[model samples]
Target: MDIDDFGPKEPTCRMLEANDKRAYFIVRDWNLETANSLRRVMLAEVPTLAIDTVEVIDNTSVLADEFIAHRLGLTPLIAEDVDKLVDFRDCDCEDSRCDNCSVTLRLKAKCTGNDVMKVYARDLVIESMPPSDKLGQPVITDADGLGSCIVKLRKGQAIDMRCIAKKGIAKEHAKWAPSAAIGFEYDPANKLHHLDLWYEGDDPKKEWPADEVRIDLDGGPEKTDEPFNYDAVPERFFFDVETVGGLSPDAIVNNGIKVLQQKLASVIKELTGVDEANAGLDGAQSPAMDGGFGNDGYGNDGGYTTPGYGGGNAYAGGTTPYGATPYGGAPGW
Candidate 1:
């Protein structure tokens, strides 16, 4: 057996840790690989400081399709598909528990919500033991007013949630602070029902990979007196899932900014060994850690105070800017 398939790279490292946390994050071109990494980071009970939830809560409830497409990293072919919204009630499959109408996304963060309005998903990863739950069993992130609640549950649990709007990384990553947040207690005796958001789509790529077997040179179909027997066909065929666009152009642009910013922050950290807080991204100027503050407080003046909102007075007043007077007060005041 080749054990090298499971080694400690970024993905593997993420799968083994425990009790981690996050503040703010910005990543781009997020695909299943990154999403899988994130799943591990959440299950390992990692900590997150910012107000963002590990789960992407679908609040609009209208853009269920968009949220699923974002999580799956599926770029829609048609622009209108971006807004091809659907709700949980769109399904006519008798029971409302099937995927003919919904898609499920479950994530957990074992941390506190003390920071209310200051959470982000940057540099955050979670790990777990059995990975994800079988179909129909999903961790729902919806609970109370907790936009970023932390729950204690084993594998195969359900999570329902809603996340905050982020203006991307450029304007500072937004935290997942719901109108309210939840704090869960470990209820051992109580059995929780697994909740899943079902959707209508069948694609092999979305399904887990099947197990592979190698037949020996002389191997043939072994006759069995057993009640059941499995057959094998070495032929291969491929099928494509129906493609549809998701998210509006504005939303794509906005989300893209956040992703790029997160990517930039990660790269900068790798090259300079600097944390996001001190990297001059979140309002503060990057400092010249060489013992003295440089020209703009950063080495080679690399950091500059972000343009405006430093003192909560909006941009510096030169001439009446937009909806304000140059001096003080409201536009006309």
Candidate 2:
């Protein structure tokens, strides 16, 4: 099987602070199968002799860290461990918020006439409606629109807080065990990991149901015509590892290359017309022109003739008294 490394390439953390408080968060394992699958699709699309090797590592801990950073008014530290959290930073706090921990901006003005004010993730804009002091709100956005927060303002004041939404993947949010807390480690030297997938076989829980098994070895195995089939020996699927974390090794294995293969087949079929049938004519092959009365053309009287009612070159034009073109552009004119 080809290896895919779609996870974090560099392991480094960044300090995140909000409002004006300090807190702690930890890194947990991350789960990503869709990204892995998309990477495989890219490999299949490209022409290469060597198969793609992917190693995705998700520091699931980041999820909690993100939430914590957003909750407390403080900057988050970038580290694998909590000890990395520190008080020192480039900026310090002021007012109820902080320049280091929280961001604050203000606007002061009095409307002379009828006007309206609006604040969005982007620049403030006044619509057709007149400005209203009670409708102004705070707007925040990062360099990229990917990160942004918008709030309505009334009476010329607005305050807002941004945090990792509860909708995201996190223990406090949404965590799916046996599929959530999972990480992948690959040894390029050996090209193997602790986890593998099987499609047909017994699992560590004795729930063997794979149609195939894919063993991701840390090192290259000796060349052999035969591969280990989990279905044949249901006992082989039994790994001593606990399924307490993310997907059991068997679960990942069960999502074997076959599933990817089927997907690839479908993608290949779509990308390349290899499976499309070229049988018969793309357009129908009607009989040769027989200049019949049903032909469509100017009749003997120089009037546009309809099919089957034609007295023109119907026979030559494949329009006969009986072979008139249908209104829907059929055999008739």
Candidate 3:
């Protein structure tokens, strides 16, 4: 079947509300399955930089080293430069860490002389910064102007640790999720035009717009003749998304689309047995074919056949109840 028979090649999007942290939009001419796929990608596939490993150098505080590491991993880091960052597993470096694949963050806190102290995300020192203007400091701050508080310490207590941040998707962990919420729903306004408002309410005039109310109650419940048409449009969906300050709402959506495209490209390459690196080469041959019956290059035919039950049908002697024929065998063979 032709590919176009599946669905529209391109879907349309319309933005209704947009801001730094939140966005609401509409997608037209797309099925519910497509809309849901976009939402899933936004929530779980968009990549972001997050603290993945921690090395504790010293700790005499109330919190254990593992607890501290857990808190550090949850602290959202500045991930706007994720596109420029490489995954540690995919990097060429043979060691456990490298500049291109990971960034180091250090935190040190001490409390002394009868005073209680608090350690926050701002205290985590980023050893290096990416060469991008869009990214700021790595720590995330709350609306109260306080960074993500790691722990509290009593007098004479101290803590010191180093963390490694890496680029990853939310599917690995919640710390890497770029968006807080992503969802879509059918627009209800599309169904409003089909309702008969006249007979549904006490005072029909008060229940709907003047143009929608058609009964002339003052003239004895008679209906005024008017031409009208329902305005319901099919396959329209409204989407709402919220970002987690690691990236903008728009960036999360754009990245989700990019990730989806890459996944589709990979699937197509696998199914077509095409080596993308050599696809553009001069006179590069296609992969060896697996015939309809999946035969090896040798002459042995590989297809379903009834062994003792079939003959004279397509195979050579007597006819059988089951229709079993050799691969590519003629009827008289």
lDDT by residue (tens digit), candidate 1, 234-332: 121111111111222222322333334445556855543335324334422112233333224333332223423244232223233423533345375
Per-candidate Cα RMSD to the true structure, in Å, reads 25.8, 25.1, 13.2
Ranking by TM-score: 3, 2, 1
Ten-residue stretch with the least lDDT total in model 2: 46-55
RMSD of 2: 25.1
Model 3 agreement with the true structure over 150-222: per-residue lDDT tens digits: 9999998898888888889999999999988876666343232434556565775566554221122112232
What is the per-residue lDDT of model 2 for residues 208-307, given as tens digits with 9 covering 90 to 100? Answer: 3322212222223423576644432111111121222222233222232333444544563454333311111111111113322122311243322342
Candidates' lDDT values, in order? 0.27, 0.26, 0.68
After TM-score superposition, what is the CA distance of residue 86 in candidate 3 from its true location, in Å? 1.4
TM per candidate comes to 0.17, 0.19, 0.66
Q: What is the lDDT of candidate 1?
A: 0.27
Model 3 whole-model lDDT (C-alpha atoms): 0.68
Instruction: Provide the clash count, candidate 1.
Output: 48
Question: Roughly what TM-score does model 2 have, to 2 decimal places?
Answer: 0.19
